[model samples]
Target: MVEDTQQPQAQNGAQPQVKMQILAQFIRDLSFENAVATKGAPQGEVQPEITVQVSLDARKRGADHQYEVMTKFRVTSSNKSDNTTLFLAELDYGGVFHIEGVPEDQLHPFLMIECPRILFPFVRRIISDLTRDGGFPPFNMDPVDFVALYRQELQRRAQSQQTEAAPAADQRLS
Candidate 1:
């Protein structure tokens, strides 16, 4: 026999309680290179074309109900015409989160998608400051679509699993 240990809050027709908190946020790593200063100013006014690449990672911490999520950004600027380098900025930022009430199976997406979504503004601000201080206009990053990114990652993982399984199945048939 099993006992039903339902909370009063949920018995009233409300959803289960979910708790999330950002325990800490910090810059894990940062690097910026100003080509205009090092390589000398390029001839003529510069048309800077900036490209920003982003990635995310997450893992459980030693403490229970705590996880660490990291967001990495690689920003590159180049002249659209002659393609000379302007500057490059790379930043790795991390956030420590204290979360509860989410089920184990859903935690992975909660960490990868929701946690980073919560941390993105800080990451964007840092990048903007880094670029502005490096002598360029403030680089405000566009909003990232975490849901789409999560979906793409899931699809990629599924494809990789299928690819791996196909070879093993072939070997088994031999």
Candidate 2:
């Protein structure tokens, strides 16, 4: 007899059980440029300072429990001395997820954190391959801290809203 390892449903009726499933994953957009590396110069001569930026967005997909999560990456490699750009790579990767039974309060974080975690490895492989095939050493990206990123973005938005509302509050005091 096989022992069942499934988690039992919550005894409390108020908490809705959550289920997350990846429906599809795809490269929504990809662009890679190699300026100096393609010229056949020695690898040491093309030392580049690389910078990467990441962003995430999620939206409803017109069906119940369906959502689309998009992760965007902007990577730039530039020469250290003259600041000439060596390469610029941008990728927009997206996944369709089926999120069911989660509370409204927990939905945002689930989409931002869990969905991206599922899709990151594929995105990482793509970046590595693109850079290697572009005639330079493969660029392996470090793992992203999605939770921290999400928190920082939330704090930024809160601060911006407070800044924008300050004048209105001051007017009411006058």
Candidate 3:
């Protein structure tokens, strides 16, 4: 005689200790452009009329997180009398990260810092690859300080909020 001791009877119960893990990750966008012809006024000279803007953002989607950190090169070289746009290139590099079982306190940092850090190398490689593919030297972006960047963004938002609230306070006084 054999005694069966196994029992399975749980319905609508707490999740069965799901082992949260990254299943898939990948890039979402990438771009590159060469604008020296517009920048140097037909001359083979590299102009200094360019502005580079880098931005980063992250959001949770489904059981994963997504990040978009873009670097834009806006070239405005003056040829004669007009501020002509010699080259305008915007490279938006992004990634989707599968995250699970992350603690609440660590979730924000995981998305804002760790996720971007992981994606940055790939983004840099793509930029260099694209620049070479676009018939130019490899474009290597400088290493980013995400912690500093995050602090700056928070400060800027706080300042903007203060400015917005100042007017309302003034109106109340009048």
Query: lDDT tens digits, residues 50-137, model 1?
Result: 8988889999999999999999999999998789999999999999999988878898999989998999999899999999999999
In each prediction, how many residue pairs overlap at the backbone (N, C-alpha, C within less than 3 A)?
Answer: 0, 0, 0
TM-score of 3: 0.65
Pairs of residues clashing in candidate 3: none
Single out the weakest 10-residue window by summed lDDT for candidate 2.
4-13
Question: In lDDT terms, how accurate is model 1?
Answer: 0.92
Residue-by-residue lDDT tens digits, candidate 2, 20-78 = 88899999999998877565443456568999999999999999999999999998988
**TM-score of each model, paired residue for residue:** 0.87, 0.86, 0.65
Cα lDDT tens digits, model 3, 106-129, are 666666666666666766677667
Location of the lowest summed lDDT over 10 successive residues in candidate 1: 2-11
Q: Point out the higher-scoring one by lDDT: 1 or 2.
A: 1
Worst lDDT run of 10 residues, candidate 3, spans 70-79
What is the full ranking by lDDT, best candidate first?
A: 1, 2, 3
**Whole-model alpha-carbon lDDT for candidate 3:** 0.56
